[model samples]
Target: MTTAYCFDLDGTLTRQELLPLIASSVGLEDEISVLTEATISGVLPFDKSFKLRVRLLRDAKLDWIHAALSEQVEFDRHILDFIASRPEQCFVVTGNLDIWVKPVLDRLGIQSFTSTARLDDGRLDGIAHILHKGDAVSSLRDRFERIIAVGDGMNDVPMFEAADWRIAFGGTHSPNRLLVKLSDFVINDGNALCRLLNML
Candidate 1:
């Protein structure tokens, strides 16, 4: 049977959140943190908050944003190794903009579903599309027989709902309470999470 593993990029695969790192490039980490917290806490919708954060960080140079993300964003080694072994079956599903997360995606060497960016003159103009994580899961149905999703945030609810199996991962921190409730499995260690994936 063909199984697809879908991992949320921030805090699941990566040790730190990408947007805050991108915000740091333009000295807007504090501002971004507010929106991020609100979004994760379910106070702000992911799409609206993501757009606001993107607009706030839009003025930062592309090179600086890339450098900040590349330097500060660290991946969970155990999870990274698992994906590297089966890159074809692993996918990073994130609400992050395409341009901002290219470095991370390139490193994983796997297919990704991310929000698209609108660029003008080699600069970030705005968001062209905001990805609905559930839609991403549905889109994979034609290809994979079974879909397993791993994530740690409120934003992952739709994805969890659409997936065949859900794992609430807290390798970096505790998975959101609601997300944990929806998951078939709750794993807090990267090694344990990968082991569960192998078992499934």
Candidate 2:
């Protein structure tokens, strides 16, 4: 079987969820976090929710977002090693902005699909779209015979459904119960994820 791997960035591949860091960088943490929670709870559509949250952080400095994300996010070492061993089969599929996730992706040497960061005058204009993660997986579908998806959020559920195998990670965030239920295999650590992938 051709095993194609797709991963969610925040709270799955990375140790921290980037949205809260971006929110905290601009002093909108409390307010924006509510929106985030609401989205996860399925109270609002992801695209509309993301746009609203991004607007709150629109004036944030690119440096602040980059620095905060770099400081807070760390790659799961086991996943890192596994990806290095089989570089061609893995890719990061995240809803987080690519600009904010640059450091981690570079270190791991992986291709990722994420929301675009729009810049008007060298400042973040806003998130270009939400539910961006689903689009990424759809694009990759035709190229792979068996797609394996992993994630921990409501936004991730759609992409997870498209995969031949799905994992719900609980190493970082408290994942939605629905995500865990849909997953074919559920794991909480990087080593465990690697083990499952190796067997498959």
Candidate 3:
């Protein structure tokens, strides 16, 4: 039977979040930072807020951002190795754009479900679609006998609820108490992430 493991990208996979870096890449730090704050605070809806940020930085060169993102994104390497040991079942399910997370995802060689953006004249035109992450997991459940999800943000709660096992990574976001209350497992350290995965 196939088992599926879905992971969030931002704080779950990196020491720093992607949007702020994408903003800084093109000197739109002020605007994106506000959107990031609003997103985390629930001031703005996640998808609309994220789209606004992307549009603001639409002129950024995807290549430059990807190269720069390679240098900026960092996270627990050991958890990665743990996933590598069981490659067939692991995947990334994020609200982030695929292009921005491509470098890190490529490095891990994992399949992903993420938002998509359109490009025009070597710049982002806008996000073409938002990946309904929880819906993605719901659909994947038909193919997998068991599904596990790990994440640390408001957007993840829905996916977490759909999982056979749900994990909140406090090492990243300030997880919602409701999510933690429902989680089968909660881990705060990166090394612990491997243990949680192994147990599943």
Candidate 4:
């Protein structure tokens, strides 16, 4: 059976979250982080929090945002290398907007499923749709025999539910408590994460 690995982008695959980095680029990090924290803690819905954060960052220059991400974001080398060995078998599943995260995803050279952004005159408009991560995993069912998911947020609950193997990673910090309860394994080190991915 063919197995596919789905990874969450923020805090799981990367050492930091993307939205805050983008917000920091435009000097709105503190404002955006309030909404980001609420969403992750389940105080706000993912779609609503995402839209609000996007609106707050609407004026941010794409070039500046890209530069900030490139400068501050660091991928877990061990996980990055593991996926690099078989890019086709991996997918990045994130609630981040496609436009905002394109550069990072391109750098990884892997397939991804993310929220779509509505654009107007080459500028940010609004969200076209918010991705339900579980649906992304379900869509992969036809192609892969077993699917493994790794993430660290409440938003990742759906993905964990949809996947055959679930891992809650704490490389950046402690994973969401609920996600830990749902996970088959909890890995915190990059090398250990890579080994778990290999075993799955």
Candidate 5:
């Protein structure tokens, strides 16, 4: 059936949010948290907030940022195993910068759709592109007959709208209220989420 699975990176696949972890490398975790909360609450738009946060942390050493993310982020084991079993059908669709989350993506060993980072001399210069999750889903239409999306936040609304099926996952926390409203299924446990994916 050429089914594709699209997963949100932060909080959905990984137990910790990547941006705050990256920000911590520069002692800006508190600042990043404010923007993250505002975005999640719909007070700040994802694009604007993402850019501001990126600007705030752009000067942090790339090696240190990568090391922190690799050390601090934890993935949901059940879901990680599920993707590992069928890596070809899975994609990480995230608004996070490609360079910042490289470690996580490498661990999953799956295709990914992420915001692009501008680089100058091996340093993070700025954001080159901000990915809209809906576009990521649309880009997959030609390749997959059916797409199933999993996420847990307000930022994921566009992705949910574009997918054939939406699952609001809360393995780390409660699924966002609006996201739950848009989802075909709401699951709070990692193992149960894998079971539902198998059934689908």
Candidate 6:
């Protein structure tokens, strides 16, 4: 049976969240983080919080955002290497804007699904569409017999529900309590995570 692994970008694959990094580029990290925390903890809906965060960083220089992400975003090398070995079976599923995260994703060189950005005269205008995590997983049902999802936030709940096996990762910070509750396994180290992926 074919198996697909769906991974959340921030905190799951990478050591930190991308929005806060983007916000830091514009000197609004603290403010954006408040909204980010609310969204992660299930206090705010993912779509609403994502739009609000994007709006707050609208004026940030695109070049600076790219440079910052290129410099700051750190992927779990083991997980990335595993994906590298079987690129077709691994997918990055994130709520981050496509434009904002392109640089990092490009470096990973793997397939992904992200929220697309609306552009206005060559600048970011707003989110054209928000990706619901569950929808991303459901779309892959026809291709894979088993789906394994790894994530750390409330937004990943839907992904967990859809997956045949779920892992709540806390390699960076503690995973959302709710996500952990639904997880088939909870792991916090990159090496351990890769091992679990192999076994799954």
lDDT of each: 0.92, 0.80, 0.80, 0.92, 0.92, 0.93
Model 4 TM-score is 0.97
lDDT of 4 by residue, 5-42 (tens): 99999999999988999999989989898987887777
lDDT, candidate 2, 125-154, per-residue tens:
776655466667778767888888988889
Q: Give the TM-scores of the predictions, in the order they appear.
A: 0.98, 0.90, 0.91, 0.97, 0.97, 0.98
* lDDT of candidate 1 over 1-200, digit per residue (tens): 99999999999999988888898888898999999988877789899999899899887898898888888889888998999899999999999999889998988889999999999998889999999999999999999999999999999999999999999998887888899899999999999999999999
lDDT of 5 by residue, 1-200 (tens): 89999999999999988889898888998999999888876788899999999989989988998899888888889998999899999999999999989988998899999999999998989999999999999999999999999998888999999999999998877878888999999999999999999999
What is the alpha-carbon lDDT for the whole of candidate 6?
0.93
Clashing pairs in 2: none
Residues 81-141 of candidate 6 have per-residue lDDT tens digits of 8999999999999999899999988988889999999999989998899998999999999
Off by over 4 Å in 3: none
Report lDDT (Cα) of residue 106, candidate 1.
Answer: 88
What CA root-mean-square deviation does each model show from the true structure? 0.8, 1.8, 1.7, 0.9, 0.9, 0.8
Error of 3 at 41 (Å): 3.6
Q: Comparing 2 and 5 by TM-score, which wins?
A: 5
Kindly report which residue stretches of model 2 are placed more than 4 angstroms away from their true locations once superposed.
none
